[model samples]
Target chain A: MTGADRPGEFELIARVFAPLAGEGAFGLVDDAAVLTPPPGEDLVLTKDAVVAGVHFFPDDPWDAVAQKALRVNLSDLAAKGARPLGYLLGLGLPDGWRTEDAEALGRGLALDQDAYGLRLLGGDTVRSPERLMLSVTVFGAVPAGRMARRGGATPRDVIVVTGTIGDAALGLKLRLDAGLSGRLGLADADRDHLLDRYLLPRPRSAVAGAVLAHAGGAMDVSDGLVGDLAKMAAASGVAIRLDASRVPLSDAARAAIAADPALLRTALGGGDDYEIAVALDEDDCDAFVDACRDAGVAATPIGRAEAGRGVTVVGTDGAVMDLGAGSYAHF
Target chain B: MTGADRPGEFELIARVFAPLAGEGAFGLVDDAAVLTPPPGEDLVLTKDAVVAGVHFFPDDPWDAVAQKALRVNLSDLAAKGARPLGYLLGLGLPDGWRTEDAEALGRGLALDQDAYGLRLLGGDTVRSPERLMLSVTVFGAVPAGRMARRGGATPRDVIVVTGTIGDAALGLKLRLDAGLSGRLGLADADRDHLLDRYLLPRPRSAVAGAVLAHAGGAMDVSDGLVGDLAKMAAASGVAIRLDASRVPLSDAARAAIAADPALLRTALGGGDDYEIAVALDEDDCDAFVDACRDAGVAATPIGRAEAGRGVTVVGTDGAVMDLGAGSYAHF
Candidate 1:
């Protein structure tokens, strides 16, 4: 930060963005960046924006907040079966923004850039009078004509999800309710797991190749699983039959659900789970599962597509239930 | 709007972004978009943000706000000689934003889409607790290894600036102080000229080809002419000797300066002049000027690079003058 109460635009680039912007010069202050797309690959572009309190806790660590911003966009890329390339950040700092807050943000971005194998290309930083906001535009590449889409699932497809789904949803619940840890009699590790998952998403980039190879259609579960599945059904003109018992959950989520059975709905309907849910040809289902396993991701078969419309979820009790308005709408 | 107090995100994409996103279906709600660059062209990317009361008047027409947001990035692209291709928008809306504002924003984008030949790839609209802000990430295509840069000038180069300068700076002054119009005795037409230039930027996209063909180095003058010229000199590691009297001024700016001779400083050191300044080989300067003229842009030789550092401004009186800290710095 500048010696003044807050950093100027140039100082903002040199410090808060330097760690992630790269070695030598900060491209953050440059006019523009130029790159050639890899041969025979189409560039995949997606943007996701997060605001203080709306998407994450305003007091959340800037590093994790930076990671959350990156991962949300990365999740979109992975769902499209694209390989990570780079990203541009648009950050809006809150009033009286301090040097430490800015440094922490840059540190968070630097850490995630290493972990996710992408670098900051270029970006813009601005001032916000009230809350902090981050807008991340991630660019990736997929082989020509091979990017997964949301409209290809058919009656011959089997549905599967990568990684546990409900951990983040339950984590969000616990974060919003401070007494939740005690209400559920959770261990410290479980509490941390839930809170961490809610704060930072683990995008399924590892299985992007497998999904590209075998999935007929795919989407990242950012909104509630049931609502997203319903969207998939509508887009593909098919019906999906999901077995709720087959839906994977982290141990922490299971603990929470065990304490309050009603929380199961929250697990199924809450947003921020950056897991890929894909529909594969029945014949390719085993191969896809194996590929994900090799990628060190847990893949569980959860549903099937049929020649009809809408999504159905049968509970552990073998009875159909209403999921309600589960999809997260950001308006 | 989504028939609620405000538009839901899906409805937002469907209505506000439809005109710019295209007709058939809104890609706004889709997972991601993929595009392959044209053969033999490298992608050029840049992002710039505008905020209410900061970049433009908070109550400025949404269309003008949208255009200003867009032109800032387009200016970057043109300075790099990149042809417009597409863009992703990240909008943060203040609490209680209305339907009209959203639609006007889209309409403005749509008008520019047709004028500038770029479509919306995708975007996100999120809620802001306070002010409305827009972050635009624009993408363009430039011929391989041909994107103009900020550094490459030498003692052998002559500096030329495109279009006129200082209109916007004076325009900004008129906007911020309604009484200034009367004090300057600005006619209605003259006042409108300054105010219009401040509210909107006419990016030098027309002469991009000319610049790429004959310029040694280039940068758009967004900050004041003197300050930006100083940056160009610093970046290229060359000293620039500018004849301040040669700096072109529009009719309105000239009229304002004629009324208040002291306002000449504001004209020379004002920001938001979205004009291109280039350093060209003395031998190639005329051809560059000719090419720009043929493309319907005015190009005037304003300065020359010398074997030294920093930037010098020679007044109409033929005396060296300090232009103050003329560059616009965003804190």
Candidate 2:
């Protein structure tokens, strides 16, 4: 049947979301998400939505769409130094969407929820016109005093980040413009790295607690390192300076940049890395790095927070260099 | 600009949802809905979604759409004997939706949130293709011992309902098929009464509290009186028998039904009236009626919860008739 003939809200919800049960918790049929934060832990809740076209390709695979929707929200919780608890989903599907597609998307969500140790609580479903939208509200918890915010950095704080940057930006560029693919003369290795970064981003939650426990301020790099760090600096009332040479890049990214230095510009400005950016005092940086190593997560020192406004990236010779404008802007 | 040319996710959210200020104590900028259930009170939360074409006409007025979306959710909270506190809304607008239309819808939501003393906590906005979808999660609080559940009704409980029923169904029928307009030949008063029920529905939150405080079990009449009452009986593991003659109707309803007796079926099976259907002990019925009288809300004894499995409607002559089919089914 066509989407217009699809089942109504209740039936569609029962078919799509009801089967993804939670582990070690209250029933999903309950009126609200019945999770109770563990003692000495504070609840951390964040919500985000992925719109058709804006957040994903209209023709993006249903499984990827579902996973991305859940993952993006999880990344927010991770940035806050919280462990996953459960989530509520609100899905708006067009009349033309197939039941199989919806089911596939649900399975993807179920997979991530199970993988992350989060239960699928409850959600609402409705019919729309053409595009599909998913709104996810995640609940997590962090030990008291361990939750991270972007406003806690001090002038002497050392800046650190998890994982490499800019691969996702390259991935998006490749996906959107075929001309870029031809220009880079990309091999399968470079193409795969970019694709993986764009499609599946890993949220760095394990080291988040350690960073928040020891560091002064932190945020996730959603909108490119430069733009997001700029936000963190503004929120923390400090200036930040990045050591351009220390910024980590995957071997594939380095190779791509070698082919064309402009690729470095993309890595610096392109976002969706889901990496945590933290600021800690110089004396605490070593301990924080040790904590990350103990957690089996990578941590790299890339910059330092200083007393000023705006962010500046300095070369090895201490000369200020311009990182091309970072991240996508709507307006 | 065409929706295809619209900016990315961050831009869309900033334009549509982020800047809209709400009146909650913590407002829309928080991590989670901060609800302080009054001391000695119980918290109740319910979520529901209204899909275009499924729950309403695609062309329904924006304010009416907002009203239906909010009232339906509030109806659920009211049935739990909770006073409305606030709601979190997740809205999905079609790609072609006008910005002004969205703002008008937002104003409608703001108006209701203010009227009900519920703040719009936080919500997500996404772009969809065909229809506009609204998913609302409402929270409220009731006296600890007075919250109602459908499973609490025992056999032999007296069934009661507040307010007149079926006007919404007739209104919808008239709106969809103008041929029915001439058949009923409704006067301006009759037309206005039916239309009012469609445009604006009041959740019986106050009446619900009185019932929950005294009645054995309760639910709001959403899927028509006959269908919803049957659901209550099913949940309570009891049967129901309605006194058809005692079903209250407005004078306009009576006249319209007289012109087309078939209208009674619509009245009996029509949904979206937002009335409270309650089961109370036989001994408590008089006291309950007195309480409703003091509260200035009408309370009518309509049926009894019996020991059998299905519903039996007793006619004016005391003959048992089968209301074999009644209710508004979305699917």
Candidate 3:
């Protein structure tokens, strides 16, 4: 049974969301939630939304859908070098939604809330006549004037990325075309790994401290690393030179690229890869990498900032590679 | 041209939304916005969502839809006695949406942002395959432990409501069945007045300071006055005695009720009247009303809280009136 089959909106909220409400939520009865500001800290706010058939497969499990809705915003907070506080959820469910779906979504939120040390603040649930849409507004806190910014990079800054990239993009391709896995000669485990990466993102929150301490600029790579790095470079009035061969890829993405060199474009230009990309002074790069390693996060040097404009990717042949349609665009 | 006719998402944000970005928004380029904490204050958060065909007519103007989406959340902040700070918007538009629609939505948001003394902090826009959906998360600030709450009412507290009730409900009826206006013997101007109230709410934000200073408990009447009062009574563990004849009604609503006595139930039991319902000590009632009158706001006393449970409406004949389906339920 889904929440649609359960009862009215208020009852559904009590059953499915009240358990996740934090102390500030007033058991979801109050019109608004209150958050006592963390002493001497600035508040960081970010909002991300996902729509059915647009951001996820229509048949994706409710739990994974809910997790993605939250993790995407968490990735933003992580990139900002802020600690999680809580979040407000706005859900528009299509008519006749299942009770089981709401329960699964609640459980998924609980799983992540525990892992991230956050809680549900308050939210509004409404009926949508069309597709399901979920929007999450997350709050975090950081020392005043110290949050990581995207426009602080300068020439000679080392471009570093946490964890492997391109896996989720490749995963999306495989999910769209199952035959691609066999075409790439991927093993079963490798196929599962790619699919898992697409289904759920592991936000690079563990290395946030290191980024805030040592990096000059940072952002989450949700819309293709190449495009996002280009944006960062443009915002900071600098250029970036990336070594295409040095761009981190999982074993499955590597196998796919080896089978079809054109797949490399998909790996580099596809979005939904929730990795943290940062730029720092060359001297601070090693210390940041060491700190990430100490925190059990993989840190890789993929590029460097330069005194120019836009992003240039040098292929293995030592020539600039032209990336058509440089990023994933929703519009 | 609508935003769908526009080139890309980033360009859309830059052209349509960047101008509305607040000082803390970083031009909508950064992953998250940073807000400096107000000195010695707690942060208040509220979220509300509106969907096409559910919350408003599918053909409603983009600007009105946008205004309703934001103002609904603002109404919540007003009920909580929090001063507006900023808001994040999440919009989902169907493919091929026109550039004119996008521009109209932006204009609408700017109008309300300026009116409410707030700014756009950050937001996300994505494509939806079906109906348009909008979600807004608003933030505000209030002195520590001084925000109005819903569960603070006690016996002998007077129930006061801002503005008139049931105008929106009657307006909705007129909109749905144009012939109803003639049946209710409404004047041309009265019909337009009712329709306007239904289309746009005048949130009682101006009286927020007075509410915080005088009211023991408060909530916005978005879900019908009688039902919402019942909820407050339940939450505060007190009984409410309301004089049904004393419930404030707009001139248009009163005219309709005079033509058809049955319409009185519609006025008292209908929803979407964004008036603030507050509870205060009887002694403070006169002063609160005086303050509101001084501020050019209409406020009226309608009932009183008692040491009991549930809500009882005493009709003009001195007998409890039974209200069937006391509130609107989305589910």
Candidate 4:
């Protein structure tokens, strides 16, 4: 289809997005919105775009796609020790988009708004020729100078991660190679768990307060464990020594890894696992873990940061392992 | 190309966009950045996306396309009576994208960042697969409760506009139909002026203070005068009577319109003119105009708002003109 051939972007936004707008949004009627700051709070901002067939399957449920987009951005906030305020959504409809699809997308956002205690702000919708794309810019707020920054990781800092790793990666493999699920002899529950994790990330938002309280450095692992840790290490001007054996794994991921040891590389390097990774002083590691546990998020000691640069991955053999092609290259 | 097939996005960002990063961006390494609210000011937020082939020709200059994307968002903030602080950019590169093209796009943004006195905060760059798309979210600062909202227009308010009305519309036609320029007997300078206006918007950012001080309602005219006025009228619960004969036009637009009277319809109803349109009390109108003039931007009288509904356009013949299509409609 040619450009601007959709029915009406304005009407869709009015019907589907206006009701979810923040009080400051003026129901999306004004040229722009006035965002009055809550006194003494600093705002946090991040933008991540998901293009069709790149970040997700085209046939994925619209609501789930919406939730995934929202959750991934919130995952960043959670790692930064911020809580949600609102978000602006940029949705580009592919040709042949239907009104019901828009409605379903709106339903997903409305449900998340209630669940997350944030409101929709405002955004734009345009025509993307071949595929649907969603670009989300989420706003979050934290107390002054309290955000857990990536550069703060120092020598002797213990690395911590929330929830299990590798399920999303394995699930993605399952998604791409349909026969892989059966080849791995995966159980029905195992298959579902991995698929759920890949399709929808469980952002560790509940642990935001804990990160602010106890962690010195933090970030969400959207680009696999090994590569994301390497990024944090490089950013912090420190070295990360990650013990693959200590890396937490779910039953589903463990089952698949045990059946096929080669899949471990995929699990460790493949991305889309939206979990919080934190670096803290040795004295605060246990407390940070306990704090996250209090939030019902599993926190595990995965590595340590040293005064050097770059990242080192240790195999179960207690020796350095070469993690060729560290993470999913798509991002 | 398949999903995630592009070269490293992280490296590209660190090399190009990182240099333009705001102080809080942490060189684009942190999961998110902190935005400290300027003392005692309300923040204004606006997002507008331009898709290739939809917003402009795919082969448009990368720098001009980048500038257009940035200017459009800034235009909204200007109309809202806010001054720029910084912005986030979401760029989607098409298949077979080159590194040189990315550098050229960066050069464009770099030039505008200097021109507009704003910093690049943080944003996302993804593979769009087929077409390029740029989404910009701009932030501006306005003193508390000083925003010029579209809903604040009142009956008896005089409408004022900054800069000429419809040169960009005619310019777009000139761009699309090269032969039309010859038929219209257009001067080279006139043709260049129209195309320049269409390709790169000159946002009336200098008049922000004037808008805040004198206007009751305001918006940028990206969607033609007639349609935009109608929107303001509806939002403000008033009626707008536009004096079409008084609408300011560039020499080129006037020449073209005089040559073909039918082109008047395209001029009035077509859009892409990024001038500020403001509604002020009759007494404030002249002062607002004078203030804009002092900023080196011309402000012209367009019409008046009345206690009624919708918008009416009166031609030089002193009769209501039927604007068959209220706007360019592509937006």
Highest TM-score scorer: 3
Report the number of clashing residue pairs per model. Answer: 0, 8, 15, 0
Candidate number with the higher TM-score (1 or 2): 1
Cα lDDT for residue B109, candidate 3: 94
The CAPRI-style docking tier of model 4 reads medium
- Please give the TM-score that candidate 4 achieves against the real structure: 0.97
Candidate 2 wrong stretches, greater than 4 Å = A2-16, A21-42, A142-147, A177-183, A242-244, A308-331, B2-43, B52-64, B94-102, B129-131, B142-147, B178-183, B286-296, B310-330
Arranged by lDDT with the best first, the candidates are: 3, 4, 1, 2
Give the per-residue lDDT of model 3 (tens digit) for A1-331. 2443585789889999999999799999999999875788888999999888788887888899999999999999999999899999999887768888889999999999998989999999988766778999998888889999999899999999988888999899999997989978988998999999999999887887898899899999999989999989988999999999899888888887888899888888888899999999999999999999998998999999999999999998899999976777787
Rank order (by TM-score, best first): 3, 4, 1, 2
Off by over 4 Å in 4: A1-7, B1-7, B328-331
Clash tally for model 4:
0
lDDT of 2 by residue, A54-110 (tens): 778888888889898888878877777778887777776755777778878978988
User: Model 4, range A205-312, lDDT digits (tens) per residue?
Assistant: 899999999998999999888999988998899999999999999999999999998888877877998998999999999899999999999999999999888889
Per-residue C-alpha lDDT of model 1 across residues A1-331, encoded as one tens digit per residue: 3356666877678766665664212355457877666899988888889999899998898888988999999999999899888888888877777788888888888887888788888888777767788999898899987889888789968999999988888888888889989978999999999888999999999999998999999999999899998888887889999999999999988888998998889888888899999998889999999999999999999999999999888999999978887888875
**B189-253 per-residue lDDT for model 3 (tens digits):** 99999999999988989888889989999999998888999989988999999888889988888
Per-prediction TM-score of chain B?
A: 0.96, 0.90, 0.97, 0.97
lDDT of 1 by residue, B246-268 (tens): 99999888899989998889988
List residue ranges in candidate 3 displaced over 4 A: A1-5, B1-5
Q: What DockQ, between 0 and 1, does each candidate earn? A: 0.70, 0.31, 0.78, 0.66
By DockQ, the best candidate is 3
